[model samples]
Target: MTEHAATGPVTRSMAVPLGAFAAGAVVAVLLGVFGRVHDPTLSGTTDLGFRTVIEMKVVVSTVIGVLVVLQLVGGLWLYGVLGRRVPSWLGTAHRISGAVALLLTVFVGYSCLWALGLEVGTLHNGEKVPVRAVVHGVLGCAVFGAVVVKLVAVRSRRAPGWFLPVAGGMLFTLLMVVVLTSAAWYVATDGWPSRAGY
Candidate 1:
């Protein structure tokens, strides 16, 4: 029984969640790049517009990169630790990684809201920027909300370990939505640079 448990169902059961995490990470990286499409080019040009805009872009990119790396490390560690059974050290690393990832995500969401140009006051083309900005903002907030729920569950010793994974999945979906909708918006407007105010 011990050998079977070690080699069979235990190992196989871990695969599903691990695969989900891998897929989510891939989606996050791709979507993160799209989220920062308007950011300064690699050379870091800042003279073309308000400093706030460029600063916000840099903040968003930095936060996204940090969160992405944290997530990848956490996901990989989680798969290994959960699969082989948690060790003392990896468990601590997992907790630390999770906390850092959540913190970065919260900031990333703030940056994302502005990056989408949906801040409290902003006029774009005589009308507020597209509602898609709101959608992206709300979704980003939801991801942060999920992390809060998961943290509460952890401290309280909750039964199900569903909140974190659910949060991850929601974040992934939101990223995709933001990417596609923003692309569509850009296309419809004939590009931001070509507009009169731009």
Candidate 2:
């Protein structure tokens, strides 16, 4: 038997990915913990010269969600896991899409935290808050953690081959949750800033 055949399945150390995941989770928790809830009226007025922050978030988040879907497709193509031949430029495209997704996510996340803070109940209108809002808030924090773990797994030589795909999937799922709960809900409920609940 060859030397390769003699050894069992290889396994890489998980320290780097684990540590990175922990760090990311901590950062996310800190933001939620320390975030100060403010009046939506004051925060809602923050605009990018032409549009309010809420409008910008809705548009940006929708674009990011689309890009994330592309990232999934590109990743699968690059790995040849979907039965498609790996294009020469697929890896580059995957990387680019992932970077753009990350950047957009970061922007939206910052805007959400800064403008809305970590909120759950419907204190503004006395309406019962939907479970989707609470889940979205929780998953928003998880998105940051997932992103950090994915970044570390992608960069670490000691990370196992399966680590990257799993991390990427987790990140994608979290983003979808955030997008669906916030942007999709906003679109379905209210088109723009006609009221103060989104």
- Highest lDDT among the candidates is held by which one? 2
lDDT by residue (tens digit), candidate 2, 1-198: 876679854558877777877887897787667444444333433555425687778878889989999998888877777997787888888888889889988888877777776777674688866788678877887788788788888888778777888888889899998999888888888774433333
TM-scores, in order shown? 0.44, 0.81
Flag regions of model 1 displaced more than 4 Å.
1-50, 57-62, 81-89, 108-125, 161-164, 171-198
Candidate 1, 127-174: lDDT as tens digits: 664476656544544454444444443443232356455545555455
User: What are the lDDT figures for the candidates, one per model?
Assistant: 0.48, 0.78
> What C-alpha RMSD separates each model from the true structure?
12.1, 5.2
Error of 2 at 4 (Å): 14
TM-score of 1: 0.44
User: Who wins the TM-score comparison?
Assistant: 2
Clash pairs (backbone) in predicted model 1: none
